[model samples]
Target: MKLSSGTIRLIIPAASLALLLAAVFYMQPRAMSYTGLNLLFNLAIPIALATIAQMLIMSINDLDLSMGTFVSFCACVAATVLQTSPLLGALIFIGAIAVYAGMGMLIHVRDLPSIVVTLGMSFVWGGLAVLLLPSPGGTAPTWARAIMTAKPPLVPMAIIASILIAAVTHYIVMRSSFGVLMRGTGGNDRSVERAGWSVIGIRAATYALAGLFAIFAGIALVGLTTSADANIALRYTLLSIAGVILGGGEFVGGKVSPIGAVIGALTLTLAGSFLSFMRISPDWQIGAQGAILIVVLALRLALNRLEKREKHQ
Candidate 1:
């Protein structure tokens, strides 16, 4: 029996996640318990959210090099102002979203490369984060801590949250009319404009949505850590990119899968934990992640080629 392209795409991430779980359980049977699962997936929420943010950018055929720094900046605000002055923190977050929207507008108006613009903004965000926190010390608000630490019966909160995030994002981005327009804008801005839609507005709205998700990622990170550091989420940029690609996203085609992206993030998270359980060095974890990504992508490429050959035959 031959699998369709959609089935193949879904299967890859699902199989990767299953394999990671199996490996972890084989190494440590105790890891199959609720407590063990919670510990293993505790940090996955932020990574999943970050991956969604990246997915939003990718949906519009753009990249956000500043995503990690922006997340760190939001974490700093959550740690400081959100803890001390809720109103001020809310305003700052809103302002940050506006800035992201403005970036989209600027990119569109100036016909600038998204990569170059976002890369420059990464330094700006990093500098602001440093000025805000200076050092790695700021407390997460009570609400943030509460949300991150909440536990429910029968299942881990991390899994529940990931499911909810994926569901909501999938509905909004893949099942809604506005989502269609945004994706169309990416797939063909000229066609979207010909249809009397404002491509620029769609792009800006997408960027704003990405900013909102990044804020969620930052807050979640702070909640889990109970503190903030400018560099805390710096590695998320690459991780998010890898998750999107592993989840069957194309960099230039406005194609992405919300459920797959979350699954991919969870898979990477578990793979990292698996390495830790094996007593591997921290430095090797990144390399291991890259290796896993490469393998999955290679398999996906092979599958695509096979599908094409079958179609031709």
Candidate 2:
């Protein structure tokens, strides 16, 4: 039977998630319990949000090398200014979003590689975060903590939040008319320009949206930890990119999926937990993640080949 591109995309994430779930359950049956699930998924909200942020940039055929530092900066702001001066924190966050928009504009105007621009911005963000919080000691605001600690009925808050993130982002980026335009700009800027749209504006809006999501991720991280550090979320950069790819996003051509990204994040989160349950060393955990990513990518490649052969036949 021939599988369509959409089916092929869905298969990878679905299969990967199922396999992870099976492995986790097999390794520890107790993980099926509510408390265990809560523990496992506690950190998923922030990762899912970060993955969405990465997905937004990937959807535009661009990448934000600074996303991790940018998120850490927001966490620093949340821990310091947001806790002490709410008004100031709001303004700072707004300024950060504007900077993201400006980066998009600069990239478009200069026709510069997104990687080069964002890589430089990463250092700036990291420096600002260090300046804001030299140590990991600031507290999360009461409101932020309350939101993160809220216990909903039947399901864990992390799961609920992940679902909502996936649903909301999917609607905004995959269903809305404006979404089509944004994706069109990524898929083919010249074509979109000919269609009477400002490609630059679309790109800027996408970056701003990504920044907004990253802010949510940072705040969530602070809420969970009740503190912040300049280097707190540095690992998120590579993890988020991996999540997007595992979830069926491409590096170019505007191919991306919000739901898949969330699923991908969840799978990776579970993979880490599964490894920890088996007493894997922290050093090996990172390597395990890389290995899992490689295996999934290889599976995706095989699926693509199968699809092509089926079509030819």
Task: Extract clashing residue pairs from model 1.
Answer: none
RMSD of model 2, in Å?
1.4
Model 2, residue pairs in steric clash: none
Model 1, residue 57: distance off in Å is: 0.5
- Model 2, 71-144: lDDT tens digits are 99999999999999999999999999999999999999999999999999999999999999987789999999
The lDDT values for all models are 0.91, 0.91
Candidate 1: misplaced stretches above 4 Å? Answer: 1-4
Question: How does residue 94 of candidate 2 score in lDDT?
Answer: 97
